[model samples]
Target: MMKRVTLGLFGAWLLHDAEEWFTLAPFSARKAASGGGQVGLPWMRREISEAHAHTAVALVGVVIAAASARGYRTEGRSRFYQAALAGFGLHGFSHLGMTVAERGYTPGVVTAPIVVLPFGYYAHRELARTGVARPGLRTALEGIAVAGGALAASHALAGMLHPATSAATP
Candidate 1:
């Protein structure tokens, strides 16, 4: 059960993020074109190109895969795996929260409730049922920090690998 949950994380992440991968660039483009004067939190306002979105998604996929593999290998005992699982759950909620805050659809919002949230909840419950140590505050915090750092790095790396065209609107 734990093994299935661990592997399921990867599949769930891919499904959730694939929504973002396909929709984010176009959504940002539309939002920019509408002159809506930035939406949601300030940090969410940055417009990105399709290339950047693709690269970032691909990069993060690797991290998710590594975390899932670690979880499977350790049978939910690895700290990193626990942190990643917690982070994934948090991230799923964030998508829903962001959509509500924006009062509109956001990339990955569709899958957040369907795939990401459900999988996160089910995985955590199964892990607990199987005698895996329940995640503590430290694990949750670590998950958030690690996920944030990875996302930042992925964005940075994407920028470097796929420089924005000057003609591209901000």
Candidate 2:
């Protein structure tokens, strides 16, 4: 059940990304028509086009899905799983921050509260219950660090692999 919760977090992230692609892409394009991928952050927005964003989201989803499967198979004790789980779960906060920062609707804003935050909190508790991760400050901090690095790397790679382009936009 705990492992399932982790997987659900990943699924929620997938949906959130979709929401961003379909809706946020336009906003980003309008924000940066200068052909830079820096929509809101350095590692985000590989391109102004929604298609590029969609592709990036899909690739990252594959990574999360694979990591979640491996973690569940290993009884939710794998570092990859833990890091990915924690990283993805905590990722919801970024959306929330973005929404608040913009003071308006952002792509992932709609799902952040309803799906992302709840799933992350739920999975964190489930992991504790399953003994996959102990409840401790150090452990939590480590998990958070790994998550940050992983997200940064994923964002960087996604942009590098595809290269931001106006062609990706509608």
Candidate 3:
């Protein structure tokens, strides 16, 4: 039951990302600009670039996964939950590294990664403890992650193709 709920939440998060691709990409770019410091200053645009509605949805999925883990721990399915947590933790760490490398580690600019990384890590650890993931499940998750990554890349491309302009009347 808890596994099902976690999967459902992740599914919903994927759908939400699809829905917000257009709007969110540009918003993220703009927010990055605002957050990035002036020229020659240590800018932190990468963290800003991750600002998207889908991120909130993903966070919600993390919460659900964690709750599900707690509910299932007695069953000795901790490894499955741990794998899930590891996957997300890796994702977060990668993202954070990208952000810091592209944009200097500004104090306030690093909030998004700082908040989400530990949350995702904890959630995954709990899930591993509680769930029993099948062999096929790992493949499916990899496929889903790939597809989601592609969709996000496309959204970023679209934003670049149709650059937003302040001169254009709202």
Candidate 4:
């Protein structure tokens, strides 16, 4: 049950990412700015690029969750499932936090109530239903989330430190 719920959430996230990448990114910046939002030009592009990266991350998470679900059910291997869930949850939270910090709290306000709330609720309920409240599983989840969070933060910081160089001939 827990695995199924995770899979469902993963699917929903993938769909959301597809919408953001294919629809929102291309025109959102121009629309927001022209509509009187004070967002700067470069920042808009940065937001769009970040959205693309997020889409990629979510796709990876979906694959991991799907594969882990199959393996766990087939072999009674809870570790992989726990690790994948924790990683996906942590990645989602990290990106949400970073977006709030970089963009402003307003976006987080919009997303939290809509996206995070449902995902967190469903995941938590599924975990409880599956009796994954064991200490070892809990510890594994915490560790995986922490490790994934660290990696994500490092990547974001590296990008900040070494931004892309572009041609001047445009």
lDDT scores of the candidates, listed in order: 0.80, 0.66, 0.41, 0.47
Candidate 4, clashing residue pairs? none
Total backbone clashes of candidate 3, pairs 3 or more residues apart or in separate chains: 8
How much is 129 displaced in model 3, in angstroms? 1.7
Model 3 per-residue lDDT at 150: 41
Off by over 4 Å in 1: 36-43
Per-residue alpha-carbon lDDT of model 1 for 41-89, expressed as tens digits? 3224556788888888898889889999999999987788878888888
| Candidate 2 TM-score, true structure as reference | 0.76
**Candidate with best lDDT:** 1
Instruction: Estimate the lDDT of model 2.
Output: 0.66
* Model 3 worst lDDT window (10 residues): 40-49
Stronger candidate by lDDT (1 vs 3): 1
If scored against the real structure, what TM-score would every candidate get?
Answer: 0.91, 0.76, 0.37, 0.49
lDDT by residue (tens digit), candidate 2, 1-170: 85576567567677767777687557666545645343356533323455556665676677778877777777777777776666666777877887677566667778878877787678778888877774556555666776566555665565566664533532
Per-residue lDDT tens digits of candidate 4, residues 1-170? Answer: 65455465556455444544454333434434445234422323333344434443454554555645653464323555545545544445644664565464322234444564566456656666666632356745664664455445543543454345211011
- Residue 5 error, candidate 2, Å: 2.4
Worst 10 residues of 4 by lDDT: 161-170
- Per-prediction tally of clashes: 0, 0, 8, 0
TM-score of 3: 0.37
Enumerate residue pairs that collide in model 1. Answer: none
